[model samples]
Target: MTILVMGATGAQGGAVARRLVAEGHSVRGFGRSGEVPAGVEPVTGPLEAALDGVSHVSLVLPMLLERAEVDRWVEIVAGSGVRRVVFNTANRIPPAATDVALFESRRAASDALLASGVPTVVLRPPVYLDNLRAPWVAGRLAAERVLSYPLPADLPVAWISHDDLAAATVAALTRDGLEDDVLDIGGPASLTGPQLAAAFGATYEAQDVAAFQEGLTHAFGPEVASVVAATYHWLAKHGGDLYETDPTAAERLGIRFTPVHEWIAA
Candidate 1:
């Protein structure tokens, strides 16, 4: 069976595509950049044509898609003969509506996909431990020996790795009886800022939320950055938990998570 992976050139999707390839599965990677894993067959032409003969899909949308764009994607996928879809929402879903554009847009997409007459599984992941390796954060950590983030000092986060998240996606795609389910996945342990910093033998600094937003604005445009930053800003004021300490759902699926220290060392 051929599995179609969207955004397979990006970090999360790249991990999924690589893992699937290593498992001897036939993988078709569709990405804007056209750079897929070594073994993946790149979908260079139309996506609709690429969906033909595909059995399952790993759907990873851009961080900021408009509601209409999300709907359009669901419409397209619904018509495809694919049997299953595993969508990575790429962030935490709020309990109630926080009115943050990014979160709400993703929520709407999840709802649309589940109701699109296709067997779909939505995976919501919390903050990624991989983010620490990004240039902006990594550079500072390397230079100053500090772990700075826009989270409260006491807030505990069960940071997940992209590879672990990829395993969950693969499980959701291959496993049965998970249709129309929304799962919140996380790492094994939830650590506070101090504890997380200690993993790298670095000092912890609570970065200002506004300053964090400004950094995002510089990297991503102001429009996307504003919406993305709004979630963190809301979290600062509302103090909603970003991760599940237990990760019971992941365990039930037989998905294993990498430890933070192990990831840091790697």
Candidate 2:
């Protein structure tokens, strides 16, 4: 089957494409610049043009974009005769109760798919573990020798690994009987900011969580600090685990989920 992947050059899409190719499937990746993995075919043009002859599609659209573009993409894909679709959605959206702008946009897209009669699956994943490598974490690791963020010490979070997300996506793409459903993928265990800090400290000789948070503020500014703080605050008050055990993912993918610390080490 020929699968067309949107955002093929990005982290999630790239991992999905690589995994599919490793399993011996033909993949055509659609991207703005038409750049893709070495084994996959890189197709030029917009999402609409890339939909031709595509049996399955994986949508990993950009976040925090205008709603119009999101709607347009969905409209085009729905009309394109693509049978199966996997949409990457956000786990947490702003304003909590109301649909997050980004997730709302994706929900709209999912609606379009349903209205068009295409089989669709939504994958809602939380903040990735690889986010630690971002300037917020890396710069702090380099400069302050501390791991600091606005998130409270005891707040627990399930930080999913990108590799695990990719594996789950592959399972969704290849499996049957998963139409019009939402799957929340999370890490195997939930850990607090201090725990993550401890993990890093164990890895790097002189680093700690205070340094991480400090570095995050330094690299991302106060807005990020506020966001991180809010996330932890909500988690603490909510008192629910972000980590979920998905036997479905494991059964379909034939692999165990990756743990947060193991992913960080990798």
lDDT of each: 0.85, 0.69
Look at candidate 1 and give me any clashing residue pairs: none
Q: Report the C-alpha lDDT of model 2 over 1-266, residue by residue, as the tens digit.
A: 89987878878888888888888889998876767988899987766668778999988876545689888888787778877888876454332343234445666776677667788877777667777677655677657656655445565666777778788788778787778777766666667767767777732232343454465568678655544444444544563544334446455445567886677667
Native-vs-model 1 lDDT?
A: 0.85
Q: What TM value does model 2 have?
A: 0.78
TM values, all candidates: 0.94, 0.78
lDDT, residue 245, model 2 = 42
Query: What residue runs in model 2 are displaced by over 4 Å at the alpha carbon?
Result: 93-96, 142-145, 150-152, 202-255
lDDT of 1 at 64: 67
